[model samples]
Target chain A: MPIRRLLVANRGEIAVRVLRAARELGIQTVAVHSDADRESLAVKMADMVMPIGPPQAAKSYLNVDALMKAALDSGADAVHPGYGFLSENATFAEKVESAGLIFVGPTPEAIRIMGNKSLARETASKAGVPCVPGSDGVVDSVEQAVESATRIGWPIMIKASAGGGGRGIRVAHDADELRSQMTTAQAEAQAAFGDKSVYLERFIRRARHVEVQVLGDGKNAVHCFERECSLQRRRQKILEEAPSPALSADTRSRLCESAVQLARSVGYRGAGTLEYLYDDVSREFFFIEMNTRIQVEHPITEMITGIDLVREMIRIAGGEPLRFKQSDIVMRGAAIECRINAEDPDRNFMPSPGKVHEVILPGGPGVRVDSMLYPGYTVPPWYDSLLAKLVVHAEDRPTAIARMRRALRELHIEGVKTTRGLHLTLMDDPRFQAAEFDTNALEGWLAARAPAASPTTTTSP
Target chain B: MAHHEVLSPLPGTFYRRPSPDAEVFAKEGAIVKVGDVIGLVEVMKQFSEVQADAAGKIVRFLVENEDAVEPGQPLATIETA
Candidate 1:
């Protein structure tokens, strides 16, 4: 089926993003919402609206039964799980497919194989993709972790086997530190992901967080180059840009090809991103894991490659083959995306959720504001803090930076604190301009700027 | 006895316990002091301790566990000496 009707099983800006793509494709859109999102922009723009459940995500968005019922009730032939919630969940994908509705992403097997960190590493290695040297599988005990740490060398990272997005990670430089942190890491992992199993990997110092965007049609896969997402806070990417400044032309080609090889090995379908750790010192990259859905930073890639990734993913889900060859998809101008979050950057990046009294989005050529914000819209605290993404493209990185600075200045969302100031400061940062930072750079920069303070009060801004 | 109502300082989801497996921070009829954590308000994934502003015995919690809350909303009532 060509997806005559689509159900968006998510909220926030991504929901609006999907609605726009569906509208352009002439697909009837159905927006599913919790009680808190009844008056959301997505609901207003959707052709039909369905209330799933209460405000909590568990009773609503994450509830597979509720989502499926909504899909069927709204007459949607396809369901778009827009990043997070159930987007990468293999069971959810299986359920959607078994229910005779199209899931706008990869096959369930691919999601299952790549969702686990240890298993994904094994699969990558089997595909001849370079991966970080680590333990063969999940470390059983603290003694076993210490044993593996010695072989993997000191400064190993204890990562949750079933975790992603930097959750349940602990780094130890020596045996004593490893022994002490091992149980804590396991407990944290179990608490966060419902899995206590963890794996050890050699922690790469001064490594840039690079990921290649790949699209597949179950048989053929092509890379859309790479994105430099090194500027992150606590493992969360705050800013991202396509065509990494760290990679040379030769290295970039090899890195992108390895990502495609890994995707092909898994028989991936739709759009996905292969995350890698790029060591600037050795000029080598290692595949860490693969996100089997449209990433939040997909827009920057779209800007540079002229490929609407969300649209392409939906088309692929609708049984369409790859539209362009590797050579046809060319990276043109440099593009950068600044994540405009509802956070107080100066006050330790505390979450700032409130009603928006005013909204001033930037315009003109090369500037795009992808957001769900509107005047009188109250940002509920039940979801992620991301309010908008200010994306800008230019001829080169420097010009892109300048354009981003201009756009950031023009963006003014009143009533709630945002990361606008932080991004503006980054635009002027020499190290950021020179692209001389890694995954840990943003945290260090933030800590230096404002020393540790007491825990944030529950006072709303 | 004087009665005092503890209001939620911020809006979000309110949880009586620190973690899912943990017990409630302060049960009803439990004696609480000023600045004692009675619950937690999670706003956009960041948790902030909901502290009682006055020393008293908690009469009852107005909302159930994991209920949505708003700023200045009464969460619990305390019977003070």
Candidate 2:
């Protein structure tokens, strides 16, 4: 079905991203926001802005009923979850579909399969994708976790069976630590993901986090190479680069093939990311999980492949076939992305929320900044701290690094503390340049270069 | 006697206290001053303190604790005196 009017059931940068894509397709966009985001750039840019509820996401963005009502009231033919919030909520997807409004995502069943990590692991295993050795089902008790750890061996990772974004994960080296971490992990998992079910996996230390972007038309799927997102702190990716430096040509091809196989196994549709942990020393890659929605680091893939993923998602939702064949796809150059957040990385990444007095974005060749910020815009404390994503692409890794550094230096936002300085330092680090790091690299780097005592704290000017 | 307008600045679940069974920040018939913390509204993970911009006596409570509210949703009617 062709989507005429689309209601974006999200806010902030992603709302703007979806709105921009919809506008390009000549679709009217309806933006739903909390009371706090009445003046947000997304609301201002959208064709119509409706108040979903208050600032709380529960009453606003995640309120499936409110979103459906808004879509109905606005005469929107489709609803886009735009990542996070209820983006992966299967019930919400089904409700959207049942309400006669097309959901701009995968099938509700696909969302259900991927939302549960254990089920996804099983699905990947069935599809011949390598997965970490761990429990095949949910571990409901500490005893089960300990037994699983003993069987899978120590240094096991306890993760929420229905978790993502590093929320319900705990790594334990011994039985005692495993027991304690299991409780904490379960509690956090319940609070964050609304699921207390936990599972175990053999922890793969020093693993490079790589993921392939895939698009499917519910029948066939195509892979968009791989992106290295190892530079993360607290399990959140801070930087991402396409055409991972760690992957050999053979490994890259195999990884992409595996991702395609997995996508085909589920008859996946829309934009999805197949995440894997690649061990450099072992040269083995294991499937982690799949994100059944548009990813935050999609810009890097776009920079390298020159494919508008968002546009393609809309097309696929409209029942279009795969736009291009596998042979037609080509990765042109290395692309890097640095997530600029409104936080003081020097001070434990505490959120720095306030008004943006002055805003300056990077430019020049290969530089792309996706943001929803403007002067006098208030960085609301009610949402994610990401202010913008700075992406750059060049002929090679070194050139891409240089471009990213230049972009970081050129980027400026006054009246709010940002992680721009941290990105600059990371781009200049020798280890980062050599690509000899793992997911823990950022945390180690920060620990080694701890900000000076009494670091200067700035507020919105 | 003077008249004052009670307005909600943001939308969220309005709570009269930090938690259930806890004393509310303000009550009906209580004299309130400008800038007084009258209630709390949670949006996402952040909790915002809704302050009274006009001094008056809270004559009527318009919303119950933990009630879902929208921006400009009336919380309490205040009578300036």
Candidate 3:
């Protein structure tokens, strides 16, 4: 059955993205918001506005009962958990379906199977997807972790089984450090993920972060190719581009095929991403984890493939088979996405949440801004610092970079600090231009550049 | 007595009461023992109790109930013994 009305179970840019897609598909859209987000762009864009609760996400976005109640009261037949929040939450997915509402993502089983890091690695191993050598299962004790580290070789990653978005992890390079870091890692995991159980994985030094986008209808799935997300800080991606800068054609094919294999093995539905850490030295890629929701870097894939992933997820939720098969999907052009966060980059990326007194968005062909910024809008202090995503596409990588530089220069937000200046600096850097940087590139660049940069906040004119 | 500040360890909404139906954990000028839970900071839906690290009397909260707080933001002042 097709969805009559859809409720976007999220806020910010992604919610606006879903509402736009829903409009294009002629579906009525409902926006759920916290009190702080009542004046947000998503609320203004939505066909119907529903208050989930108070300013805190716990009382609002993360409140499953309130969300379901809002969905029911809004007459929405389907709910789209637009990445993060409850997107990969298995119980929330189950609750959505159990309440007779269509959940516009993977099934609860896929989420449950992939949301758990240890279980996900096992599933990938069984599906013939290569994974980082690690403990076979959850490491029970310090002795078990030490044993696994010795066997898997030193420089191991102690990760929380339920960790995602680059939290609940610590890297250890020696036995003594391993023992010391293990306790801290477990405590951090317990505090962050509500799970103290962790597993160990061989840490790759200076690895490139690559991920493949895939769509499924539970029975069949296809890959939309890969994205290179190597320029990250603290394991959180800052910039991403489609058709990995480092992978050869053969390597790309293998990586994408492996992601599709994992998705198919899990009988996945809707849009999901399989993340991998690619060792540029050996040309070997190991499956890291599967993100069972639309990724933040999805626009780059959409720009290159000319596919609307959010729309596809909605269609798949409506019982529609994928319109295009593996053969029909063609990747063209190169797209680059820069995450503009509301942070003072010169101030060690401290959160700079404030009212957006003014906003100037860039335009022109091949440039898109997925954002919810408007004048008088307050970038709430209660949530993630992401202010907007600026994406640019062109015939090739250099052109894409050039376009991104121009687009970034034209974009501006007043009354708050943003990451735009850092992105502009990256665009002009030789290493970034040569695409020779890895996940540690940003941290290194910032360290070297921090001393020379003045304390004054630099805003784009 | 020196005034000691109690700062939030993370960013979130600060709560004066434990819950809606519960009483406020502490009141201004109330004597507090070391390591006593005085309030809570709710971030990402997780409640972390704001404990008084020093024995003191409450000197009023810097933020209102349900107000958003940030890491290192002063929650309250304590008149340390």
Which has the greatest lDDT? Answer: 1
User: Docking quality tier of candidate 3?
Assistant: incorrect
Candidate order by TM-score, decreasing, is: 1, 3, 2
Docking class of 1: medium
What tens digits encode model 3's per-residue C-alpha lDDT throughout A1-461? 99989999999999999999999999999999999898889899889999999887878999999999999999999999998788888999999999999999998998888888999999999999999999998987898889889999988888899787667778998999999988888887777677898999998888888999999999999999999999887667899999898999999999999999999998889999998999999999999999999989999999999999999999999999988899989999899999999877776666677779999999998999999899889887778888899999999999999999999989989988999998999899999999898888777888788876533322111
Q: When only chain A is evaluated, what TM-score does every model earn? A: 0.96, 0.93, 0.95
lDDT per residue, candidate 2, A1-461, as tens digits? 78999999998888899999999999999999898899998989999888899776778988988998999999998999998899999999999899888999999999999988999999999999999899987889889888888999879988888776776678899999998788899887777667888889998877999999999999999999999999887677899999899989999999999999999999999999999999999899999999999999999999899899999999899888889899989999899999999877866666677889999999999999889999999887677789999999999999999988899989989999999999899888999899889998877778778755222322111
Best by TM-score: 1
Higher-TM-score candidate of 2 and 3: 3
- Measured over the true interface residues after superposition, the C-alpha RMSD of each candidate is 3.1, 7.0, 12.0
Arrange candidates, best DockQ first: 1, 3, 2
DockQ of each: 0.55, 0.11, 0.14
Q: Which candidate number would show the highest DockQ if scored against the true structure?
A: 1
Please report the TM-score between candidate 1 and the true structure: 0.94
Instruction: Please give the ranking of all candidate structures by lDDT, highest first, separated by commas.
Output: 1, 3, 2
lDDT of 2: 0.87
TM-score of chain A of 3: 0.95
Off by over 4 Å in 2: A139-148, A172-196, A451-461, B1-81
Better of 2 and 3 by DockQ: 3
